[model samples]
Structure formats: structure tokens, C-alpha cells
Target: TTDSGVGSTPAAEAVAQRLRAAGFPEADIQVIGPSARKKNVVARLHGSGKAKPILIFGHLDVVEAPKEDWSPDLDPFKFVERDGYFYGRGTQDMKGAAAIVVTNFIRWKQEGWVPARDLVLALTADEELYGDEDGVDWLLKNHRDLIDAEYSLNSDGGDFQTRDRKPYSIAVAAGEKKETILQLVTHNRGGHGSQPRKDNAIYQLNAALDRIAKLRFPVVLNDVTRAQFDALSALESGQVAADMKAVSRDPPDAAAVERLSEDPYYNALLRTTCVATMLEAGHGPSALPQRAKAVINCRIAPGHTSAEMLQTLRETIADDGVEIAWQFNEPSDPPASPLRPEVFAAVRKATDRMWQGVVLMPGMETGMTDARFLRAAGIPSYGVSGTFLEQGDGRAHGKDERIRVSDFYAGVEFYDRFMKALAGG
Candidate 1:
């Protein structure tokens, strides 16, 4: 169930009605929650054999896009095909995958092909806006039985060709960084704007923000990232490979880590990162603000906790007047799903068959996803998508987000085969 928009419900019922019209039995398909704009769309393709169903998951929610900022041709809700790509708010960020899943389900039914394992499709809500009322979170909490499965594929990772469209990098997100909201508050005496006080709250808050901006958190590597770096190192050139290898070693080579940190991607993987995102101060035009607050969004490494990170931040920006407040903290470590024989073999065999020996690297996602919720429930979840995107597609949450039509269709093929193989075994 994807949040239609913030408080708005998605048009999932319309999608659900379409599924029912496509020959899905009423019992085989279930729409949970109210019949509002946003709701979960669930469809089951019953398997023939004894294998447990494989849950195929994606979100229907797209971040809100202001029409004024975009080009006249770009409308967030309209699915426009332009330059071989589908232009929509949810095109690449996710709804495209959902559409593929829905299409695959309908096609599977039409073919009358019963798989070895059932395929469960769940399109959920409230992901773009991080809230407790998320579909996955709600399901895990209230309706765990509906999602019982041996394995699942989240809609976040996949193979994408290089800028030159040569080789492909098929990333499988094995884990993700945890989120910690750090609130920093500085208190000082209030006075008229014309007559400023020595201990101004804004000034003090600015100093803390400045320190946070300049301060560098120490690098802390984990098992997943180590493997990622090692794999990338093998593919890179002379200096790049050498640098990546150095940083991937035990007791990380400080020089190499420092140098590689210059590259933002590798840098974030190696350390706990904190960025100041929101700030608030002052009430009126002529009044001096008594208190100032800034929110720092920090993605903690596996072993660290919110408290520990907050303490580090407090110590880093040493100031007795500035007090740190925590807005929210959720543990982000995914339960152990070994990249060893059993799980790895299935993924490798499927990916290799589809991509013709593309590199399948077990990587950590910098951003969070529904996989975290599943992992917390002792279910092994892998963030793998079957599509590919060209270079310069922009980050998931960035502007002009898009995915190629070929990539979308390729995902259907890859997932169809991959799911069949996984369930067959």
C-alpha cells in the first residue's frame, strides 16, 4: 500500500480492480485496509509444488514533485514516454517495478503456468515519507501471516551498464545504514534585534553547525562493505584498484581510506555520516531568538547506537551551551543472511543466466528501505531489482529521476526467470 501522497491514499483500488478483471480469482487477490486513495495491492500466483512462495515487493508511493519547478512536458502523475524513457515521479524510484510486477502476475495467469513456488506481489505505501504507518511496517506488526515466505526481493537494486554502455554492475543490497535524527539546541538570552546580546542563540547555533560541517567522522568498515570494496577494486584501474584494496584491508590502511574518502560513495561506506538538514530559529522580525535548533540526519554503522552517535556528535562539537536532542532512532542492522553457499548460489545462478556473467556484488544501501522491516522479523530479505539504468540517471531521490523502457522490460524477463528458478529449487 503506497501513500497516495503524504496523507493522500494511492489509486491502488483501481490497480486491484484491473488485476481482478485480468482473471485473478477473488480469493487469490486481497486488498487490505480502507478503500481510500492509498492501499496495499496483493496478488498470489499459486505454485504447483511444495516450495514456499517467494515474495516480490515494491512500493507504489512517489515523492511529491512540484509542477512549477519541472518542465512543461513533465507531469508527476502522467506516464509520458520521451527519449526512450518513461517520465513520471515514480518511474525509476519504484512504481515502474510495481508495474512490471503487476504485469508479470497478469501474464503468468494468462499462460496458466503454475510455478514450483507461489509468487506473492505486495505493493505498499508511505515509503517516500518515513512514517510509522508504512504498509510494510504495519503488515509486519499486525499481519505477519500474510507475508510468510522463505525469501524476498526488494525493489532497489539491479544491473546498470556503464556510461559507455559496456559492462554491467548488478548490485544486490545486502544491508542498509540505520537512521538517527540528531537535534542540536543552543540557548541564550533574548533581547531586541537592534540591541544584540553577547550570548546570541543564533550565533552559538551557527558555530555548532559550522563545526558539524567541518568535522569528519572516523571510518568504520563492516563485512558487507569490505566485500563490496574488494569486488570493485578488482574491476578498477591501477591507482583506483590499489586504493580500494588498501582501504578494504583489516585495520584499514589510513592513507588509502583518507584518499578514497575523497570519492563520496566510498567515503560514506567507510564511515558514519551526519548531515545538517533542517534548522529553526527566531519568531518575529524585530525580536532576538532565545533558542536555536538544528536537525542532523546521521546514518549509523551496524555496531553503533543512536545514543553513542549522539555522544560522539556532542563531543565533536564541544560546547557546554549547546544541548543535543534526539528526534527518533531505529536500529538498522539486517539479520544475518549468509552470502555463503545456499542463498548466494541461488542468486548467482539466476543473475549469471540472465546477465551473461555480470558482476553480482553484495553491497550496503546508504538509504533505508522496507527490507529493514522484514529483516527485523528474522526474514532474509535481499534488495535486488532486475532492471538496468544508464549512467546519469541521477540518485533515487534526486530530480529528473527516470528508468529506461528497455530496462523496465528487461526486469520483467529477469525476474520471471529468476523467480521461477528460485522457486523451482
Candidate 2:
């Protein structure tokens, strides 16, 4: 849900309404948050007291989509079904997955089929804001008992990946890079706009940024990414395939690294990335003489620390003049979730039933997700929703965002099966 009207209250209420209709007591259907406009929905369906509870979750928040930025025929807020596709802002990242989770939960509740363990459904807000005041971490901190489970199944990260609208592989997110930010601030004496100084704050900060831009983190791969390159190596052929195999090994061939780094996606997968996202200069447009600040957002690869990343930035910028500090940083290190065999087996069972010839493998998320928080809390999280998207067409957080209707329903079935298999219903 976007902030255009009320916050995520409507979506949370919708989930609560369905749970209540399915005979869930008001106590079981909780709409909780700091305010009415911002809240999260948490409910549990009981089962036999045989195993640990399972948590299934998706974020209600979607990235903002300015109406003007989208195609003229489409509005980001309205749900439009055309050409076998459903178009909207959060259809893919990921109100759609939340809907599927709720649908399957209510379906099981209505059928009165008890599983081996309880199923917890958490439809939370502010995940797009990195779990703000109303997101998963807030819920975990405020009411951990309500949603505690053995493992969390994040429905945002997809299980099935389709390149060129064809099945490429079933990817389970076993690794996620850490998310952190470093702020650079420069202070200088104020003067008139007509009087320029070489020691100006803006100029000094810009020089440091220029140096930071040219900086590149070293190439490395954790278990998930190494497995990804190994599986994709077979799918690709010729020089690309050879490079994938080459880069998968330690002390990777220098020539292969150079060739693969040419692709932006592969490069991001290969190394930690830090890029300037926000900048603020002098207080007034006419005055650029006082201070300048810049925020460099970094997605550090696994097995690294915020301290290490900070040191890297300091050495790269090599500017003692520009003060650098952290801005609400999370732990830059969370050991990669172990690639459990049972989880992969369940994912493969569902994927094989749907996409025949598709390969199954573990992968890493270069971007951050709520899974990071859960993992840090010692609850290993597996991101294996069945959502499949066409390659080179992921418009999440961009204009004209959409998901194929076929893929959506297919994902619903796949997720339902995947969960049932995991829980042994």
C-alpha cells in the first residue's frame, strides 16, 4: 500500500477481515502498530502439537510510483487486468504474494484440515522502508511471542526464476547481503556565492565522492552465490558459461572476472557495492560555502562487518577532512543461512510439478530484505516464494510495474504445495 491515502491500514484490515470471517476470534486477528493508519496483521492457524510453528510473511508496502512516470494508459494505484497480466504498484513487490499467503491460509482454515504445526501469517508494513516503525522488526521486538517460529518463509524472494519468460531455475534465497549506509559531511567557512574557495565543502565532498565512485570492492562469493554460478554455468554456453564456472572458483581467473564485470547485475553479485544516494549542500541555493553532506548506501556482501566496510571507505576516500559516520546501520554480517536439504527438497518438489525441466539451486540476494533481521535474531529464514517473473522485465520500484496473471496463480499453487510439503500437512 502506498501513502497516497491512508497508510497500510486498509490492507491490514482486509487480512483481518478474512481471518475473522473464517472463524478466527478477534484475539487471533490482530491489527497492531503505533497508529491506525500504520499497522501489521498477525494471525495463527492452529494445528496438531507435533512440530514447531511456521511463519509466512509478506510486506504490505510498495515503492512509491508517481502516476506521471508510468505509461499513459496505466495508473499505478488501480488494479487493471489486461493481456493476461495484472498491473499495479505492489502487484509483484509484493502485495500479490501477501494476498496469496492469506488466500492459502483461509483456504486451509475453511477446509478444517489440520497440519503438523501451526502456521503464522504476518502481513507487515514499512518493509519497503527497511522495517520502520510498523515493520517486521518492530513486531518482533514488541511482541516476539506472537510470531515466533522455527523458520521464516519470506514470500517476497521468489523460488522460481524465469529468464526470457522461460523457466531458468528455481532459486531459493539462502544468502542476503547486509544493508548499511555511511554519511560524509564537510564543513567550511561561509562566504558569498561570488567568492569561491577551493576548500569549499561541496567541492571537497565531491572530490571524495569521485574517489569513492572509482572504488570497487573485491570479488568474492559466499555459498549461495557460488552455487548460483555453478548452476547457471550449465544453462549458459560458450564464453559466458566458462566465465561463470571460472568465477565460481576461489582466486578466480582474472580474465573471467574482467569479462563478467562488464555486466552490471553480475558485477553487483560479484562484489559489495557502495553508491551515493542522497546529497545536501549549503542551506541556500545562493550560498554554497558552508557545508555539504552525502549519503553513500552500501550493500555489503556476506561475511563482512560494518567496521570493515567503514574502514574500506576511509581508505578509499583517503580524506581526513571529510568526516564520515554511520546513519542507522544494521549489522553488516549475518552468516549465510545454511543450505538445508529439506528446504531445497520441498522447493524442488513444487517446482518440478509446475516447471518441468527447470533446475533448482540456492542463490543470494544482493539487496536487503526483512529476512536479514530474522537471520540476525538466530531464526534462519528461507526466502522461497513461488513467484516467477520474466527476465529483463523486473519493474519493481519502477514505473509500469506488473506481474503476469498466469504467474501469480501459478505461484499461489506452488507456494501452497511448498508449504504443505514443508509442514507435512
Candidate 3:
């Protein structure tokens, strides 16, 4: 709903104002940022100093949505409650979870409750922008003490995935893949449409893209994914379950990998993924292109480096004509957050109370998040929230973004339980 880069400051200020109204001192509730538009709100609920603070945070920004792009019955900017669902840009991607966390923190304060440790809530800005300068990274760099914590739970992490409208898994994102953007370029002399040649620039570019389309990086299981599948194996029954168990082992079953790779989400969890996104070719419709370029975005697995991916691309294309180069805005290559037993235990206690028998999944994010920066700064971050989304109907960053109204309230209640469990109110 809000403009992509220019954060809705009124929203951030409103959150800070709410904390103050709820008896949070002015000193503990702050709206800080580089400018008026791009701001972050951080609030604290004091606790007994029995343990270091734990942060629960999320960004205020959502991906840009144009009104014309949404369905005829919906508006991108406005929040609507209809048919047991709340419709808006950020309802699914985050803001719903943000609201839940803030409510829980305020509830604790009003009840005169004290936790075993401080609970820091950092509602930040500009996370949708890759390599953003004013969000979580900015807070950690410029004002570490305000939001520093022993560990963090990012509301950006999704929870409670459903299959056939049945709740099945509670995913705790313990790790995420770093991203590297690469541009594949092909250049040749311009010519008239009538004078086609085998070494045409456009043709060369297409061939390189075609090769990448069929390429699948070999499966490499990091600790998070390995544990994730191990749990899934017990929860699922059939060939998929066997594959999950097989892939987590030291010598991963190639046949099992092939079977699981049929699903895009599972495939992404198993290895790095590179696919062409943007393309630029001929200057005119009928003209032979003098220069053609295609951009490929790669979500790299935990252990691999961008340099290594670049080499992999070059080797795959196997063509001297293609000049592949790694693009800028490189993401942080931090190690995965160690799967601490305490965090999982807390998550399990809360999840089992709500969605009993649901799988407790310690998964990896195939997509990137600001957690990379936090992980780089030695603040272990996990993506945990009570918001549930349908498996295939996750419309985040897409048209008609919405969340089930019942699920939203359930999330509010779940956060209440989770916060109490983790901090011991």
C-alpha cells in the first residue's frame, strides 16, 4: 500500500505513538531514521536481567503494487475485510504479524508483567529494497544498543503453511540463501533483418538462457535444511517422505533428489537456483541486435560463494561469445543461524498448543531477508511468527494480497503464547 522506497512515516510514527499511549516511556519508544520518510520505530519492554534481550522485528514496507494490476473487486492500497479474509498489500507479507507482536508487547506492559529478559521490538523500513541502507542494517550499524539482542525473531518469516486448506507445518526459518545477480551479455555487429547470421547477438543470448533454464545445481544440504527434511520425513507418508529422509543423509540419493526436484519450492531448498528475469535485446523490431543482455538472479545455497556461482555459469554456457558478469548489490554471505534447542523448544510449545501435531520445521529461506545483516552482526535471527498462509495461494508481492481473518486473530493469540513461552512472563 505504501510507496516502496519512501516508507510511510505516518505509519512508523503511529506505532511509536501507540507504544507511548500504552505507558511506554518516551525514552523507551523511539522513531529513528535517516530522514522523515525512511524511519524505523524501536520500543522496549523492560524485563528482569536474567538473560540478554531478544528482538522481534519486521519491516514496514511492501513491494510496489499498482491499482490497475489488482483484481476488479480489490484495491491495492486499502484494507478490506470480506469473506473471512483481510485484503491489502502487506497483510500476508508482514504488517499482520507486526501488529500481532506490538499488541503482545503492549499487553505485557499493561498487565504489569515482567519477562525473564528484555523484549525489543524493532519495526523497520525499506527491507523490500535489495541492499537497503535504512532498515535493520542501518539500525544495527548506527545504533546497535537500541535494538541489540541475544537473538531475534523476524516477523518476515512465514508460519503455518497449509495443504488443501489444512494446517500442516510451523516453519521456523533458521537460515536463508544469499543472492547474486549475474548478467549474461552477447555482442555482435548490427545487421538488417534480411541478413541473418549464425553468430547473431540475440540468438547467442537466447542459447545461453536456454542452457541456464535446464541447469539445476547439485543438491547440497546445509544443517537447517537437513534437520527440516528429517522432521518432514516423519510427518509425511509416501515417496516424498522417503526422499526427505534420503536427501538429509550424507550420501544424498540422486534418485530421491530427482523426485523432490519436481516441486519448485523443494528444489529451491535443496540447491542454489538461477533463472533469467530481465532481458534487453534489439533496438528495433526488425533489426539484428548489436548487443543483447539477460539478467539472471541466483539464490545461492549457504556454503557457495558468488565467485563460485559465476564460474558455474561460465562452465554451463560453455560459449566464448557469452560474457557473463556478476551484478552488483551483493547480499551478505553469513553463516546460517545455529539451530539452538531452546528456540525450537519455545516454538514447539507454542505451536503444539495451537496447531497440535503440526510439523515443527527448522527450514531455510530460499528468498533473502534483512536477517542476513543481523546474522552478519552476530545477532542470530530466526524467522518466526504465528501467521499462516496457504501453500500454493501465498500471494505475497502479488495481486490481491490477503490473509485469512481468523488466521490473523489466531496469530495474535499465538504471539501472546510464544512471547510468554520464550521470555517467561
Candidate 4:
């Protein structure tokens, strides 16, 4: 379901109404939001009261997709299956996973299966884009007890990479980089189109961006990345694997780091990354721009604070005229989740049952997720998805977003077993 109301209120409340119709108690299900348009839905399946609740969360929001950008005959809002893939806006991004979680919850209830502890299914809103109305943030700030759990399984993490439709490994997102958005504004005196000025706001902004484009942050590694490289070694071969291993070292190989730094994907994994996403200058094309503003989006690595990244950015820009400021309030640094043995064991058990010989690696997502907020709030949040997407098959937030039909069903089966293992069923 799409959150047409901008927040999840319309869609989430729809799901809650379905849960209520399916015999869920009123007290066990809650739809709360700061606004009526944006709501977070929570449903609890009570157990024998032996253990703390386990949270399974997925956002109900999808990134906006313009109709003109999509392929012919493909409406982003409509589900269409072709060529063994289900095409839709949220197909791969996560509405598919949310449906899986809700389906399982209903199945367990229908089968009269009781677990050792409560299982909370949280379908939240406003995760695609950030705002004060973030569903996860709102829930934690207001009704923390309704959805509080020892740990959470976030479906909005990373893709489960596969090769030739065969599962090679599942990258369990153990940690994620935090977001730091900065606004770079350059000011100049407005002038008529006929009168050319040397001090152009747009030119200064472009120059600053050019410097940022060439600049690279120093490579850094944490437990999650180190373990990721160690696991990745088995999947990769030759120098690439060797370079990965070397770069992951406590004292990383300088040559290997230098070589890997040339690659964007690998570079993002090794260090914090910032890029100019949006730019605006002048009111009209004929007018001399009085002010130019560019938005720089940074994914700060774990163990680094946003303030530190901002300071580094300021130094990199170094232009006195380019005034830099944080787009959002200063962010609190969230620590990486530890590799708990029990958690790994549980993943292994489920993976073995689903795709035997498939590896499960502790991966750190390059993009930020609500998991960071949960982790900052002292909950061990993990990005775990059973859905396996082939290499180069990821289509989240892109035109004609789709997921393999087989992979979708496989995910359904995997979560059924996974939840049982986690809840001691």
C-alpha cells in the first residue's frame, strides 16, 4: 500500500483495520501518528510471557516516482508481473517484505501457534525521506512501550545478493552509516542580464562542488566491515578478494586501500562519502543569481559523528564566501551493533534451512536506516531479509522497480522459520 497522504496514516491505518478484522485485539494493535495523515501501525501477538518481544519493522512509504520516468505500460502504483519479476514501486524496496510480515502474523494467529514471547510487527512511515514526522522516531518518542523490543529486524536494509538465481550469501546489515546533510550557500549581488558580473554565485558554488568531487575521505574500518571483508573473501577470488582482505586489516594495506579507493562501491564501504544531490540558483535563467544553494548529502561511517564530518567538509570547501550549514539538526552518533553469537546462530539456522551452504555476513549498509535510531536508543537493530536478488538486479527506488517472483516466496518461507527460531517456537 502506498502512503498517498505523505505520512503512513492512510495506509498504516488500513493495515491496522485489516488486523482488527482478523481477530486481533484492539489493545494489541495501535495506529499512532503526530498527524492524522502520517501514522505508524503496531500489532502484537502475545506469547507465554517468557521473553522480551522481538520487533519486525518495515516502512510503508515508497520514494516518489514520476510517471513519465517509468517504462512504457508500467504504472508505478500498479502491480504488474512479467519476465519472472513483479514490477511496482515498492516491490523490491519493501512493501513486498511488509506484506510478508503481515501475512505471517495472520497465518500464525490462524494456526493458533503461540510463541515464547511477543512478536511486534511495526509498519512505519516517512522512512524514505526524513522529516520531524518520522514514524520510528515518533513511536520511540511517544509510545515507546507499544513497540519496544530487545532487538528489531528491519526489512528496509540491504539486498540479499545472489548469483544466477542461486543464493551465495545473505548480507545481514548489522550497522549503517548515519546521514549528514549540509547546505552550501554562496551569495552575490544581483545584477541585470545585460551587465555581466565577475562575482557569480553559481560559478562559486560550482567551483566548491568541483573541489568536493575530487576530495576523498580517508578509509576507516570497524568490526562490521572487517567481518564483511573476511566473509567476502570466500565469495570473491584472486586479487580482488586479497585486496578486500588486506584493506580490512587492523593496519590496512596502504597499496590495497589505494587501489580499492578508486572504486566507488568499495570506497563507500571503506569510508564516509559525501555527494551533491540538489542545487538551486537564481529565480530565472536571464537574471544574475543573487544566491546559490547546493545540498551535500553525506553518509558518515560508524564511530564518526556528524559534527566531525561537517568540520571536515568545512575544511574541504575552504571557501570563505561559501557559507555551510547543516540542513537538519545535529545528529547523535549511533554505535555499530555488536556481532552477537546468538544472533548469528539464529541467522545460520534459518539460512541452512532455506538455502543450504549460503553464507551470512555481518554487513554495514552504506545508506542510513531507522535502525540507527533504534540502535541509538539502546535496541540492537539488524537489517535482515530472506529475499535474494541477483547481482545487478536491485531496482529499489528506480524506474520499474521489481523483485523476482521466486525470491519473494522464498522470503516468505524464510521469515516463517526465522521468527520461530528467534521467538523460541
Candidate 5:
């Protein structure tokens, strides 16, 4: 297990010991790098040599949750059970998944069910704050042999019944957007606050922001996203379904794109998006600034490049004085794991066994995950956590995060069957 934010070392060590006590071999389990309290724990259960190994991945780190904002009786780290839900910071996003993986490992060992392939569980850290230190990035760079596998199931996809309690849930997630951070700077001659200048850096920076906010990039749909919308539309009713069907049949219409973009979820799938997250200007409140800067977080859609997005920004801002600098760039294309018949069949069979014939659709994730790294390694990867949830729970990365205990155990069953089916056990 790993920890996400400040003070993750203790939590990571605690979870490691728990795994050891639960019958994981001490030599096979290794905790690496809790730099800034970030750490990743890896364990494996060797299988009969019937199929290639599968990697089961989950993040141990979580974003910050303040004690005051939570319920008075709630503790972020304390696992609580109420209303069939297991509540805690990492419940959904996703210590629960890690627990499921660990439990299954033990169960498989106890049952002596040596199936087709080996299973590697990588509970990683620093996934919440970018994967620089103890997360997938570090693993891929430093310890590839330990967790390398034929395919990977990165935690973060599954079906959740909507707020209205729909009977079906979507089982999908294939590709993800590439994350890029850019800094925009506007500079001007320093002057006293008492004497205002029209071309002051602050004014220029605000103007650039205004232009960025108003401009909308053209929509470009890839195969994965198109498939996702089609499957989702098939499951819905009313105009939403109709809109999705229309777009699925033809290319993304300007009108439809405009409408869908208004919804935060659909907007991300359609095109690259930029959000200005941080701003700084002037040395002090009383001083006039010589320079102003803003940090823009851009998620480049598949088929888009950072260079192209940067060029688009330059054109949109249209100010020679405003300069842009790249803070970080990890250019990625959608992972090339084909929605092949065999792979799809495996997922479908698993879903049918678990959910009694629920529709399984292919989806592209808006947020990035470690699948990108595995894909880069020429390994096929998919996000296929079998746990289902109720929509609008606002649990992931939010306060009062929880997952149904039954659902957690169900995921274990699904994954066990999935591995067996995939490796031909």
C-alpha cells in the first residue's frame, strides 16, 4: 500500500505489515521509496503456467480531506461500516480495491487453486499528486521486472447504478487523456500602484485569461470515445440517448458537441480542455507588479499533441508580450490495446458471470492512470474493476468515501474468474 499526501509513511508501513500477517511472503512483498511519505508495495501469487501473468494495480495514496469538513464522528483513516458501506479516505479511490486484491491472493493460496497465470498486486503511492516519486512512473523506470505482466487491470473503472438506481452499470475504460502543465506569463515595466498603466502585466494576464475562457477548441473524436458514447447512449433514455445515437451514427455535430460540452463529463471526452488553476502577480499587495503569471492545466485528448495545444493557445491569446513556458510534459497517445475479440470476450464472460449478463462496453477515461506506463511497455492494459456503486455518491476523492462490502468482495470474485478465463484456466 502507498500513501498520497503528507504523512504517508506510517500508513504504508502499517498496511505492509498487515499484508505480511495475512500470509504474503515477506521476501516477495517489498516497500520501496516513501520519499515525502510516498511509497509503493508489491506482492505476487504465482499461478500454474497456463497463461501470461496479469497485473492488479491500485493506488494507496489519497487526496487531502480536512477533519473539520468531515462528519464529527468520522475519521479519515478509520475504516467504518455503516449501511452496508465501508467508509474511509481510500474506500473508493481505492484502498478497498487493494484490500480485495490482497484478500483474493490469500484465498487463492489457501484454496490451492493454482490457475492459469501469476497475479501481481502493485499498491502504489503518489498517484494523486502526479506519479513522479513512488508511483507507476518510478516503478516503470526502476523496478519493471517485479511487476511486469502480459496485461494490467488498473483500478478506477466499473459500473455504478445511477442516482435513480438503474439496474445496470457500465464496465469500461481503455484509454486516457495526456496531462500537460503550462505556465503563461505577462510582463510589463514596473510602476507604482498609485499610477495605473493600461499595459500593466496584471491587466495583460487577465486579458489573456478572458480570451482563453471564451475560446473553444474543435471537437475530435477517437474510436475509444466514440464507442464509449455509443454504449452509454444505448443504456439511457430520452434526448440523451438520441443525442448519443446521432453522434454515433455520424461525426460529432457542432450543435451536439456544443450541447455535450456543457456537461463536464462529456466535455472532456470530446476535446482537449484547459483550466487556469493558479495565479500570481506582484511581490506584495501594495506593490505594482512587473510580471504576472498563471498556471494552466491542460488534458490533451487522444490524437492531440502538446505542441499543437501550445500553438492553439498562442493563437488564442494573440499577445506577443505574453510568453508561455512548459512546467511539465508527458506526451501520450491512447494505449494500443485493441478491443480484440479474445480480450473483449474475456471481460464479457466475467461480467456475465458476475452481473448476470450486464452489458460490457469499451470506454476511454478522462483522467489519466498508470495504464499509460504499462501501455508504453507494450503491455495491453484495461481499467476493469468489477465493483459497482450508486451514482452521485460523491465518494471518490471526496469526504465520507465508502464502498459496499459486498461489492468489494464481488470484485475479488470477478477478478478471480476473469484471470481464469483470460489465461484459459
Candidate 6:
């Protein structure tokens, strides 16, 4: 188990040191970062100098887990297997896959096997926080040549849905939504609590929030979403299936839109979504609120701009009194990576080889990942983890996180086939 942000460096360095001890050359291994506690480990294996290298990367970081919150029998750090599941903090979120990648690297070296093209492993740091000292961003800016590859395969993406322990679909993330934060601040003169005015800052802020809630960004579809619906339609039944097929059409079905909009998950996929996440108002309980502010968090759809969304917010509120501004750490979002046929084909072949008859679907992730940075850096990255978790059992960053032992072992085999398909034997 690893601490959310601080554990990445030591854990990564430990992996690098182990590789070196296993006779891996020092020139091919590096522990790079800004400080001692925040390092990223990178390693490479030389192959025939024919094709561009393929990157297999995952962050060592996992979200914080407190022992007090978990069941007594389940400790966050202790590895335990019960009822076919491996219980641990980072079991499902990522360390499971991270360990798999590192193990594969070691196994390949021990077996004296080399691929047709070079393979790079970038076990990074600060991906969970994604602050100024992001590992992937630093590497791209300062040491691009070290980890640069034709494309990258990240364990953060592909999602497997199962029911009753039977795997259904393999959803491979081809793109992801961008994150944007907008601040809505309302300022007014404070008077005695005895005289509450209509233009009170708190009242104005509440009104603005109501308007924002009622406002719906226009429905838009991209290549990824369309393919997602096309593939998902087969799995769904009744109105859900019809709605999925309808949304995939050139002119989306309006009734279908209304129906799906009722569901938050599908609604987020249909268009950019915004919600008031943080609120601040009033100095004291007895005082009139002089200033009221809120932080609006948005997961914007691909091909949409924060500027456009801000404009829409202003128009939706239709009020000049509420002042709005972008957050200081606004996201510098990258363009959605274009879907490539070969990449999807490779994922499908790998999935079919491991779990035959499982559907491979293209998806756009609502949450952000390091893949965005790689995509912006001109390295097409895909999220295609081999592990399967039940439909509602994805305990990422949640309490009592665990993973199926069978799925964990299966991923090792899946990745082996996947790398061969992409880089050739």
C-alpha cells in the first residue's frame, strides 16, 4: 500500500533498485524527479532498432486510506485474500496493474526475451494530485527523450464490467473529458441582520446557482461517444438500449435525450456537466452576508471550450451582479486523441485472446488521467487495463478497496499478449 502522493517516489525507486539488482543496466534505468520524496522511475529494454518504442506506464500513487474507516478484519495496507478477492488499499485502483507491469519487465529480462521494438516503463508520481510537480509533465518538459514513445498503454483506462462473476464488456478509454473550475462570487454591502435586502450577496448567489443547475449544456457527440453507444447498445435492453442507439444517430433522438438526461452518468457523457462543489458565505450567523462565493466544477466534453461554457453560464444566469472568474489553476486541456484503427484492433485481439467473446468498446473517460498529458505531448495513449471488476465493485479511492485474484492474474497474461500485438514478437 502507498500514501496518496508521498509514497510514489520511494515505491518507484525501490522498483528501479530491484531491476538494477536483477542485472538490468543502469543506463536503461533512471529515478528522476524534482525532490527526494517525489521521484519517477523510468526504464527501457533495447530491441531491434526498427519500430518506435511502446510505453507501458502507470503511477505508483494511490489515494490515502485510513485504517479507522475500514472493517477490523480488513487493514488498508495488509494484503489479504478472502472470498476470491485480494483485499488491500491499492488493490483495484492501480498498484495491482503497476505491479503487473514491473513484474512483466522482470520476467522478460529473466527469460532473455526482447521485443521487435523498444519498450519503456514510466512508473510516475503526483498523478493523483496532478499539481505543479506532475511526474509525466516534468518528464515531457525536461526529459522527453527518456520516455518518449510511439504510443503509451496506461492501466488507468480500460474498464471491465462483470455480473455474477462473469465478465461482459471490455471498455477501452480512447479519450477523456477536460476539467475546468469557475468561481462565482457575489459582493454586496452588509447591513444589520434586522434589514435583509433583496440584493443580499447570499440571496444573489443562491439564485445564480439555481439557474446554473437548471441550465443544460447543448447535447454533443464525438467519435468516441458514438462508438461507445454503438457498442453499449448491444449490452443494454428496453428503453436504455433504444436510447443508446438513438443518441448514436446523426440527429439524436430528443425523447431519448430527455430519458437519458435523467440518469447522471449518461447525462455527463452526452454533454459538458457543471456543478457547484464549494460554497462560502457570511462572516457570522447574526451578520448579513456581505460576500458569497462558489466553486463550479465542470467536466467538459471534448471539442468544447471553457470560455464557451463560461459564456453560457453568464447567459444562463442572465444577471450582471454576480461576478465570475476562472480558477487560478485552470486546466490546459489537450485535444482528444484521435481514435486509431490499429490501437483498437490490438486491444480487441488481446481481449479476445484472453477472454473470448468479450465485447471491446471505445469510451471517453469522464475523469482525467495522465493520458491527457501524453496525448497533448503527441503520444497517443490508451487506457486498457486487463483487470475485471464487478459493475459496482470498483472501489477506487474508496474504503475497503480490493480486486478479484483471478482478474489480477489474468491481467498479467492479457498484457503479455497486448504488448506482443502492439510491438510484435
* The 10-residue segment with the lowest total lDDT in model 2: 127-136
Better of 1 and 3 by lDDT: 3
Q: lDDT tens string, model 1, 247-340?
A: 7788788888888888878878888789999999987789899889999998876555566677788887899899987787765555434454
Question: Residue 175 of candidate 1: its Cα lDDT?
Answer: 71
The count of residue-pair clashes in candidate 5 stands at 2
**Model 3 spans > 4 angstroms off:** 4-6, 163-166
lDDT digits (tens) for residues 1-425 of candidate 6: 25444557778779998888767999999999877777899999878767789888888887788899899888888889999889987788788988888877887777777788899999888777735365888899999999889888888776877777877898888788888788999988888898787778999999999999998999978888888988889988999999999999988899999999999989988999999999999998888989999999988887887778888999999999999988833456566667878778887788777665687888889888888788878898888877889888889988899999998888888777777787666
Q: Model 2: per-residue lDDT, tens digit, 1-425?
A: 77656688888998899889987878777899877778999998888876778888888888788899999999999999999999999887898888788888888888886788888899888887853657788888898888888888888874566877777777788878888878899999878777777778988999999999998888878788888888878888999999999988886788998899889788888888899999998878677568899999998888777788789999998989899988868743787888888888988787777777898888888888888877887878888777788877788899888898988898889877887877775
Across 1-425, the per-residue lDDT of candidate 3 in tens digits comes to: 25544475777898988888889999998899887898899999999876789998998888888899999889878899999899998998888888988888788889898998899999888888867788898898899999999999988984578776667888799889988788889998988998888888988999989999999887868889998889889877999999999999977899999999999989998998999999998899888899999999998888877777778888999999899777754645787899978888888888888776688878898888888889989999899878888887889999999999888888888888888888885
Candidate no. 4 TM-score: 0.93
28-136: candidate 4 lDDT, tens digit per residue: 9988887777788999999987677888888898888888999989999889989999999898878888877888888788777798889899998788876535688
Better of 1 and 4 by lDDT: 4
Clash pairs for candidate 3: none
RMSD of each: 2.7, 2.2, 1.7, 2.2, 2.8, 1.8
Candidate 5: clashing pairs of residues? 4-61, 34-38
Candidate 2: list runs displaced more than 4 Å. Answer: 25-27, 190-197, 282-288
Question: In terms of lDDT, which candidate is strongest?
Answer: 3
Write model 5 residue lDDT over 299-411, tens digit each, in one string.
Answer: 88867878889999999999999999999887456543666566668877887776653656777777777777778777777787666777767588777888877777777
